[model samples]
Target: MLVPLPSPPPPASIRTQVEVPLALPDGSTTTARVVTFNGLVDGLEHLAFGLGRYAERHTAVGSSPATPVRLHSECLTGDVFGSQRCDCGAQLRESIVQLATEGGFLLYLRQEGRGIGLYAKLDTYVLQDVGLDTYEANVALGYAVDQRNYTVAAQMLLALGQPRVAMLTNNPDKVAQLRRLGIDVVTQVPTGLHVSDANVRYLAAKARHGDHTLDLAQLTGAGRARPRAAP
Candidate 1:
């Protein structure tokens, strides 16, 4: 049977441009100068899109048929404050270095707290502290387990006039979502870690229930193997 396709989401209505810089190897970073407003995209942010500037003078790198772009989600606790619970901070910084060297766009999506907002997400953390899994904690706070979406990134990529991309991700869902939405994903690059003591169970909950694709080898990290498989 042929299944009906999903309706395209509504376009975002608000936008603003801001510039940011990226740190390069050899100990320096290039500036974007002005943030290219991706206009407005939906799902993750109320008016979600992205902010980026040019690394090289050319917004779209020529010669390279498939441009490399890093779709980074905004993680307040980890990215900004250096929280050890997750690998977001490491992923973001590493991606910047790599992108700066290769000259690509870092589509920084402002999806804080896994789309649960800042305050409520903190409350979820409290619940997690009391032993509830990440998914359960989110449900307890009336939020979906993993609400981050990449459609906006796809649109932004299109707006940048690129035909295809080499995406950086560990979640298979990200790859599938981009492909299903008509974005060309030439390569899938893994970023960051699998689990930590601070986020071991949280990562397990994600891999099990949230349909995220992360392997245990990334998690076990040279420790005694668990008798069973990772969630």
Candidate 2:
């Protein structure tokens, strides 16, 4: 069952766009038409990047070869500072390359720390250091395990004329949430695992607790010791 938004969704429209060339750490470069939206239900400044022939491609609803899309939440530590405590930075980079090749959109959402805000996330890290898993740390701080909402994501997609999409994510909840919000997710694409000594436990916790589609075998076999089983 789905709970409706508090109010009817506000009409959304393209507010602006700019062509920006992106240079990745891997020495690859591609240009994206970055877009901003107006009239989003939540007034946050979420952005969408049009990649790989988005301007020339057919964007009709239910068009063949549904547009590839990745809804990326903001991660300051990983995305900006190159922190390896999580796989966020790697996933974002991979998404750009893949979306660019496939011709799609990347919705950069301003959801930090799973929607708990930056300060709270740092507090959770203290709990995590003392043996709490990610979700447990969030709960210990009196926050929901995950508080991300996709209504805004759906709204952005609808405004962009992409009623249907092929979602790039390992989290099934993202797919389910989008479907419930009137966005047709025709495909669910998984990202490669980014396992490291610093983030092995974090990845395992996501797979065990959040039901993220990650390979435990590969996680443990990535030349790193296996994290203890989740409680």
Candidate 3:
């Protein structure tokens, strides 16, 4: 059975912030005002990276244009180890670049493996190797297809006084969930597709099972070679 989505959470408060210069994949550096929060509903140590003109946008909350934001879930393998099985790493990189240049917040949620945790994610990989798709593997292990909740994301936004936003993502769930949690998702901006030979099946599974906005023909068509796996 599916878990019920939590009601909109009470506004959280900013706990701390630090100026961190991040090095990107292309040898470019951008300064990020990384923020931590207090009173997030989940109580996980999720982070919010303020990039570009985030300070300016925060002050312009009630103005004509809404802030730009991306709710990125944690994926250790793809994000840290450069795994090619999914687009999480690519999306992270893309989000950093786009938000850094365009001004936004990257809400790094701590829902590893769709909220199942790191070990279960690895177990799912093993099940995938045996012909199970990502969702199937997750269910076979007695987990929901996806167990993430965006209540914390909304709280983070509200705490920052930026309730309205232009959400950047391909997953409709992110939009709907954020809206349900009381964030005004003014517009949905799709991320550029990062397809590769190794991620073809994984991306296809996301589209088929999760309704992520991904083009199947393009994924199945000619693509780049696989990225080198992490050591």
Candidate 4:
């Protein structure tokens, strides 16, 4: 269930903004401004990137609907070290390339391990190795399947002057949560990356229980199936 937060006192606010050169996968360089924010609740820092000259504008320009946005949570093992336990690193890289070309923002939230923290996530991994699925492992450990909340994400978007966006995600919960928090999600752009054998079942579990719109057969190359359309 998605619950709305009562526009709490800006959980996140920009601390500093700087322009930096971004290296693309095609060996080309693009300029983007990196905005760092301080979390009022957790006291942690979160980062967001504004691509192209639009960085100076802050909000989305033109009358062509909302701006493109990707709300990516922190995954140190998968994103930084490229762990195969999940497809996070691949999705992050894909989001970067897409955002760079399309001109949008990528909010890198500091909610590691779906908000369970790293140590507990590692324990869940051990439980997963013993035959439990990701959600089951979390439940067995007496935690919600997903402890992450999108309140901070919504506040960050509002702070960036982007109250609406064409969200880049496969999770319906994200759309619902954001909308509930007053962020209008105009459309959902799926991260249609294929899955590996190392995490096929993990992805399947998410699709089955997490309400993620994914075609496991297509992702795993088991068939030529299409993902379900967003609601």
lDDT of 3 by residue, 26-74 (tens): 7988888888999987789999888998733234555648888999999
Over 1-231, each residue of candidate 1 has an lDDT whose tens digit, in order, gives: 111124232333324444556453437656653334434455444222122334434454464556767777778888878787766776676766666555566777777777677888789889989999877988898777767776676666665665488876767777777777677789886665534567776666667876666665456552222221211
TM-score of candidate 3 to 2 decimals: 0.91
User: What would the per-residue lDDT of candidate 2 be over residues 62-106, giving only the tens digit for each residue?
Assistant: 577778899999999999987888889988988888888878999
Indicate whether candidate 2 or candidate 4 has the larger TM-score: 2
The TM-score between candidate 2 and the true structure equals: 0.91
Error at 108, model 1, angstroms: 1.1
What is the TM-score (0 to 1) of candidate 4?
0.87
Which runs of model 2 end up more than 4 angstroms from their true locations? 1-8, 55-62, 222-231
lDDT of 3 at 135: 93
List pairs with backbone clashes in candidate 1: 18-35
Q: Rank the models by lDDT, top first.
A: 2, 3, 4, 1
| Candidate rank order under TM-score | 3, 2, 4, 1
Q: Model 4's lDDT to the true fold?
A: 0.78
- Between candidates 2 and 4, the one scoring higher on lDDT is 2
- TM-scores, all candidates, are 0.75, 0.91, 0.91, 0.87
Give the 10-residue window scoring lowest on summed lDDT in candidate 3: 222-231
- Tell me the deviation in Å of residue 182 in model 1: 1.7
